[model samples]
Target: MTHLHRAFLFLGTFSSLVLSAAVSHGQSCANSDQVPLTKVKLEEIASAVGIGTNDVELRFEDFALETVRPGLPIPHNNRFFFSADRRAKAGIANVVPDGVIPLITITAIPLKTFIHSNSVFYESKAVRRTRLPPSYQKYQILGFLDALEHSPAGSEGSFVPAIVFMTTSDVKAISKKTRLLATVQGVGILHTIACEIPDVLPTENNLQMGAAIVVNPEVYILNISFPFPSPPGSPGRVRP
Candidate 1:
């Protein structure tokens, strides 16, 4: 099948999963619409995803260059709020507790950075309400190398790797400290995080937030020195 066909199939499957989840949860089957997700619930969900409450925050806006750049034009919609290192210190945290906050801890690469890194992973499968079998022994992790070898051009890029936690019986038996593994075909295995939170949470255009990869920036040395001016009328322009 063509890459376009695969994408369609992939999206269709995920759509079905979301719809099924909404119906199963009695969220909004009457209008064929899903229920809205809440911030408190998102925190619970993120926590269940194996990250601490302080480690993950829900983001509702597109990332801007200002995050990595300064003195740039910042387009604040006033609709989305973000809380983080400098943002929180700037009183951005007074807006809402669940507004976009840091999803990882200090010293860990930011979620945006991870999304743009080469160490990211992803899962293409739709999660169900059923429990993952204790005897289940297969992997479903998709990584960068696998994308290079398998994903179609223009589509092989970084994405937030999401793993769904089942809210059924099997999860209850697993300890919160225990980490499960799910492998992707031809790829590596991802640590499966089990949360009791349901999938009925609100989503933007039906797109639920996925799991995130953690990365660290490279260590580099900075040599700071002012350049000496050349003789008068030098070919190079000098800073005033």
Candidate 2:
């Protein structure tokens, strides 16, 4: 299908998804007429892609971008709350008078740099509700790599090679430490890190990270540097 047609289809599917989610909230439901962004006159788009003037600001949030409480005819304003970043590209547009085509701005933010080896790896003390699975097998870690890198490789260009963590059943379980994972800053589309452990957390090395993967900057990272400080009488040295 055409891009515009697909965009509209996405809108419909998205709305239906929202309605389904809201129903789970135990909130009363009602059908409200909504307008698509096509009504606002996207200069790049030569013709109307949708009907109606009702539109909501799209913000990347907790489960991907969508209105706060969609399917309801309520006024919600989406003010530009993004700042400059070298890794992310921000886009802006607005509704204007029928005779005027408003100016739009797009900016890219750097969300990947924060995930690099140099960033902070906060501990549980930082306060978080995310509890990953107790143990993640090698296959799981590689699954993540496959999704991120499209395949595990050390090619000429790609996000930094993903370190696959070995299986471990508990946080205290010393499997191995490899890299320094960091939580960054901002409302981002970050995946909850699950499963695996490093053989050794890098204390020194030219360890780099992916250049532009969009992710939340406020997640958590465990500060891992050295032969991990294990419990009393336990093997402190990283297992080869």
Candidate 3:
């Protein structure tokens, strides 16, 4: 029962706990084939959890248990863009326009939801912040192509408006400095599209920015193909 021996015992126990927790997290997130979140689920979670509302507080102390269930359907009408391998590449082809793409292997407690832990404890007014969790604070990872300088056909704009949950890690991992002629599958043909760095929009916070793209007025996207790297035989297109 020496003091040094006791200290060593405590450290060993702590390390064991940490390692176990990490392994459990990895197992949950490894289910990459989990069902994508759908518009219905998005609305359900938003309503159940009060996402996009003034009440920007954690509904529970532990997000891992109370957070929206992992593997919920990702919302529809979201598309991801990537840097083109060829400068002359004009469009992405042969994609399931009405299909869903699972970009992130979502876990019960997203890394951001845990890392941005202040939101769980502080009031929005107290922190002088606006956007709330389950939506703004906790977002799915998305691929953003930094190269495309697309704007409204006649007007040159730097950013476009998009709707989805994106993480900072996703942004850093996918954004390539090269640009390309981006496009989405239209009703009868592939319509040219442009990807832009989103600027701040007038949300409740008025300081939130996102990754977005431009589309032709005639073309409405029913679904999008997010080009995140996936394991072989996984659903959704992995190539542009």
- Once fitted onto the true fold, the runs of candidate 1 whose alpha carbons sit more than 4 angstroms away are 1-117, 129-137, 141-240
lDDT, candidate 3, residue 11? Answer: 63
What is the full ranking by TM-score, best candidate first? 3, 1, 2
Model 1 has an lDDT value of: 0.24
| Model 3: CA > 4 A from native | 27-240
Best by lDDT: 1
Cα lDDT listed for each candidate: 0.24, 0.20, 0.22
- Candidate 1 on 158-230: residue-level lDDT in tens? 2222222212122222221112221211111122121122333322122222221111000000001111111
Best by TM-score: 3
lDDT order of candidates, top first: 1, 3, 2
Question: What digit string (tens of lDDT, one per residue) describes model 2 on residues 124-220?
Answer: 1001231222122222221222222221221212223222111111222212211112121111111111111133232211111111111211221
Residue 32, candidate 2: alpha-carbon lDDT: 16
lDDT of 3 by residue, 1-240 (tens): 999999788666655554343233221122333322222332333354345433322211112111122333222222433323222243332111112222222223233211111011100111113222211212111112112222121012312222222211112211121111122312101111111112322122111112112222122222211111211111111010
Cα RMSD for candidates in order: 24.1, 26.9, 21.5
Model 2 C-alpha RMSD vs. true structure (Å) is 26.9
